[model samples]
Target chain A: MDEKDKEILRMMQDDFPIVPKPYKRIGDFLWMDEVSVISRVVKMMQDGKIRYVGPYFNSAKLGYSGQLMAINVPEDKIEAAANAINKYDEITHNYLRAGEPNIWFTLMTPNEKRAEEIIEAIKKELAIDEILSFKSKKTFKIKVNPA
Target chain B: MKIIDERTEKVLKEFQNNFKIETRPFKRIAVKTGLTEEEVIAIIAKAKEDGIIRRVGIGVRPALTGFGMNALTAWSVPPDKVDSFGEAAAEIQNISHCYDRECPEGWIYNIFTMIHASDREELENIIKSLSERFPECPYKVMETLKELKKTSMKYFK
Candidate 1:
């Protein structure tokens, strides 16, 4: 990406305005025309540089409770375990990380009971003896602007 | 309980990921969600004011971008130090997420921080700097080997 593309990305990460004509507002800030700004954003999206552009809702306010779950899946069973966990749409993020609990994922549901129910199902499906789950007690920061 | 009205839900459901990429994006959304441009803007702007909408922004693919190495480092912070540690970590530009979570039995890591860097060396350096800041708290850097699944939360649909 060019320097101008990078600048546009930084603006997107910081805040894409909520307005009828957001591209124009962004154009006003960067001294570019609305058409140029929109084209660059489109190009970036086509290039796979941009994942998604929209509003990031506060999950808690939306009545969703989330927890971080870790399961120590044996090396041979990693694939099966991941497949089982990934079957649920509630599992938004699943990753294979280096540690004792090699598999970690985030599960968010409408309430704690549903979250627990999914946890139990995963355990049963995997035949795993234990899964370590951590619910957020306090959120200090969550602005994931990695531009 | 659903705090938002059905119409607002419809707007969110449509715009979360499939937001238009045109100059008049909201105008397009208005067309799709059957709301007027002004009404759509009003709902989104009010949601932003109410803190339900964190920001109308873009989520970049860090791994696809220059930032290929990401780690979810868990730290064992004492109750008294968690607030200070969280505040300090949050201030760092590279540190994206910091949270205090309940530790499961036999686990000591309570404070979790997510960091992304361009490479392994840079990730280690960032963790080293964090270690220096909170020398007393031991941490485990769970370097991601693979992203099995990563997607936005589908609240309505």
Candidate 2:
């Protein structure tokens, strides 16, 4: 990404305009055309400079319960376990991190009980020993931007 | 102008509830909300600009993607260095989230860092290096055990 791309990203990340002509608004800010803005954003996504381009909502306000859960899975079984766990729409994020627990993922459900139930199901189905789930006690803040 | 019209509200609510992973997803939303494709797109674009909505993009399940080792590491940097430290920490590619959070008296953890990657050893190494860089500041690692909820905040409802 060049300086112009960086500038465009900065604007998009900070606040995307709410107007009939958003690309035009962005273009106005950057002194570029709407077509140029739209094409640039598409290009950025294609280039993998930005993983996503959209609104980020505050999940907690939506009445859903979420937590970061980790478990110890054998090196050989991670892919299988991940595939199994990822099938659930509730599992927003699943990742293999470097830690004692090894496998970590985020589970979101309609309520707390369902959240626990999902974890238990994973534990039972995966037959994984030593499952540690950390329910978020408090959320300070979560924001993502390209710096 | 209030960016959210009745039609827009309906579409936003649907998007919030069901983020379908399909081709031409917005068209589906338009069908449900009784708005034209251009109208739906316009409302979403407007909502995003107003900050009433944030991003309309894919929500990656990070752990499922193999970038899972995540933790919130807090450090107590001297007041003078907090800004630079935050900038430095933010510059790191692996550090996804960085901020200045409130800390208790004499146990201030003013600087916060989030490290996400596939390897624990690498995460530890990065933390170790951070500790070295800010030798005076005490730090603690709070690993996420379970992701209880990971949905976006829906304001319209």
RMSD in Å for model 2: 7.8
TM-score of each: 0.95, 0.63
Model 1: clashing residue pairs? none
Candidate 2 per-residue lDDT, tens place, B1-157, comes to: 2444677678788767654423345676778887876787777776666655646543344564356576767677787877777777876777876756544334456666777767678779889887788788888776655553343334455
Listed in order, the DockQ scores are: 0.81, 0.10
Candidate 2 lDDT over A35-109, as tens digits, reads: 777777777666655555445664554456666566777788877787778777788666565445566666776
RMSD of 1: 1.5
How good is the docking of model 1, by CAPRI class? Answer: high
TM (B chain), model 1: 0.93
Write the residue-wise lDDT of candidate 1 on A1-147 in tens digits: 898888898878857888778888888999999999999999999988897889888999988888998998888999999899999999999999998889999999998788878989998998887789999999999886653
For model 1, the stretches where C-alpha displacement exceeds 4 angstroms are none
Q: After superposition, how far is residue A137 of candidate 1 from its true place, in Å?
A: 0.5
Taken in order, the candidates have interface RMSDs of 1.3, 7.6
